[model samples]
Target: MAGTFGNCGALSFFLTGYLQRNPNASAAEVVRYLDAKCQGQPDQSKRQHPQIRARYALNGPLRL
Candidate 1:
């Protein structure tokens, strides 16, 4: 798990869960929500970079 975060963080995992629960929500919305929820959170682990996080969130499954 640590290794995974070191590579890409838990952004994708969280986004996946969020989408599962809120299937109707847009990726952009999830990103905004995550940005707000994760703001000020420590990233010394260098896993949850803003760009990568957004990319993962935006690239997640869409609700067609």
Candidate 2:
């Protein structure tokens, strides 16, 4: 998985679990949750950086 997806694998795995738990989550909410999980509490010792760094350009909340 790491060889194929690199750091994105971790992000995808986490996001998958999050979506499974919050099936009604919106796009904005998903981004916020990912940001908080990946960036807000980073592991400095491992040199971890956020995989998600941009926001979507949608006119309204995009539900997923």
Candidate 3:
């Protein structure tokens, strides 16, 4: 809970929620977008992934 790896569930939840709201969104947009949305919760983001960091961009550092 102090790094960007152990929060798979939260990441998936966030992405899923975002995608539900935005059906055919871009990866970069999603990631960056999510990053901004969660910026206020730095503590929860302790286990954030690279893809989450980069807004889900496959071209970015995707955890998958």
Candidate 4:
């Protein structure tokens, strides 16, 4: 349902996979990483960290 739709989106799927592989990273670091990968700077996408965190919390930890 709604849960599947949110997690299965391409960006979220890739982000989840990447974050899972880098569990030692702090969320700020993850935000910076994601921002860099998205062709933007960390400050430019500063808003995404909380969104990612929220999604991570809601969706559960990426398993594997």
Candidate 5:
């Protein structure tokens, strides 16, 4: 997951799988989940990429 930046296909694939497992997930939850899965490891070497970021227009959780 180190070089996942700028790769839309990989991001889509990962998101699809996560959504399948958590169909009721909100937009913010999805962002956090992806960030942890891709870059939350204790080993810095495993997280070569920056943190995942997303913006949503809503005051509360945006359910997908």
Candidate 6:
């Protein structure tokens, strides 16, 4: 069995499909879109990994 982030390639597949659908969107745009999509959830609907990825993608690679 797979864990939350290791689910049978579904996450990667979904992300690829989503990016394909929004071909013109930038990485920041994708992050914002994902944030907006989760806006109705509790705790302001924020995600940890995506935010970290956005930081690296938009700002640059991490130091460590």
Expressed as tens digits, the lDDT of each residue in 1-64 for candidate 5 is 4224355434466788899999999999999887766554333333334343233222322222
Candidate 6 local Cα displacement, residue 54, angstroms: 27
Backbone clash pairs for candidate 4 read none
- Candidate 4 vs. true structure, TM-score: 0.43
**Model 1 clash number:** 0
lDDT by residue for model 3 (1-64), tens? 1234344555566777789999999998897977775555546435546556466432322232
lDDT to native, each model: 0.56, 0.54, 0.58, 0.51, 0.55, 0.45
lDDT of 2 by residue, 1-64 (tens): 1111454544576688899999999999998887776553334332323333223222322222
In model 1, the runs with Cα more than 4 Å from the true position are 1-8, 43-64
Mind giving the per-residue lDDT tens digits that candidate 4 earns over 1-64?
Answer: 0123243643465578778899788888877765555553222323334555576543422222
User: How much lDDT does candidate 5 score?
Assistant: 0.55
Better model by TM-score: candidate 1 vs candidate 2: 2
Instruction: State which candidate has the highest lDDT.
Output: 3
Write out the backbone clash pairs for model 2. none
Better of 1 and 4 by TM-score: 1
Give candidate 4 regions above 4 Å deviation: 1-7, 40-64
lDDT of 1 by residue, 1-64 (tens): 1114434445556667788999999878997877764664444453435665665543332222
- The per-prediction tally of clashing pairs is 0, 0, 3, 0, 0, 0
Q: Which 10-residue window in model 4 sums to the lowest lDDT?
A: 40-49
Report the lDDT of model 2 for residue 64.
29
- Model 5 residue runs over 4 Å out of place are 1-8, 40-64
